[model samples]
Target: MPEPEKSVRRQEEVLRSVNPVLRGWAAYFRYGASKRTFSYLGWYGWWRLLLWIRYRHPHLAWKQLRRRYYGADRITEGGVVLYNPAKMRVQRYTFRGAQISTPYNIDEVDPDGARFRRTNHDDVAFVGQVSEYLA
Candidate 1:
């Protein structure tokens, strides 16, 4: 989606334009249940790139395009690596449960008063409980 007119550019140039956006998207969504979404994004990116390559080299076959762009385990062209969203590791936030300190019970939770105050303590506790139960 980032490089709308990359059909005239080289593979490395297109990758340079697209990788940053892909990296940012993956980073923003990594801290949630986003594995499936990441996989779909990766597949969609691959398909779009392949289509671009086909447009660029209409005379070449799919095998030639694959050999030119894809490496053994990753997509690489002109020494530039293509960012794959599926490679991003999903990290779900851990629920501290009762260990989490709230503004009302900050003194009880942390005797040393090192923790910050949480304004919406009830909402935070409910979400944490639900996440913990689901996990």
Candidate 2:
């Protein structure tokens, strides 16, 4: 909740600070059964912003504040757009049945494991010496 005493701050500043957090939260919950949750959160955020506006301008009537801040059912103030989570589409993950294959389920013949074995003893000894020095 924003402090009414801090009403000195501009509406754009508040929106800019809050938009990123709302965007990230909405994105994280978008790929699941979260439509209801998103809608609830959107309503909650809208109500809170309305309360903040009321606190900031106690002299103004509700109609004036609504006209100034809200348009076409969207909240827009000082050219800053409020991120509404309800607008996010929920996409359920579909099972890709039998489309994925694991190493154990592969039917191909295994190739030779030591196809690139080191043939030079000198090179092998140099690597061993380097490893020992590092250890």
Give the best candidate by lDDT. 1
Score each candidate by Cα lDDT.
0.79, 0.75
On a 0 to 100 scale, what is the lDDT of residue 87 in model 2? 89
Backbone clashes in model 1, listed as residue pairs:
none
- Tens digits of per-residue lDDT, candidate 2, 1-135, equal 985774377777988888899889999989989999988888888888888889988999999988776642467667788888888888989985334444543443233332223234578766896799999
Candidate 2 error regions (>4 Å): 1-7, 70-73, 103-135
Give candidate 2's error at residue 101 in angstroms.
2.7
Off by over 4 Å in 1: 1-7, 70-74, 104-135
Report the lDDT of model 2 for residue 134: 100
lDDT of 1 by residue, 14-51 (tens): 98998999999999999999999998888888878888
Model 2 clashing residue pairs (backbone): none
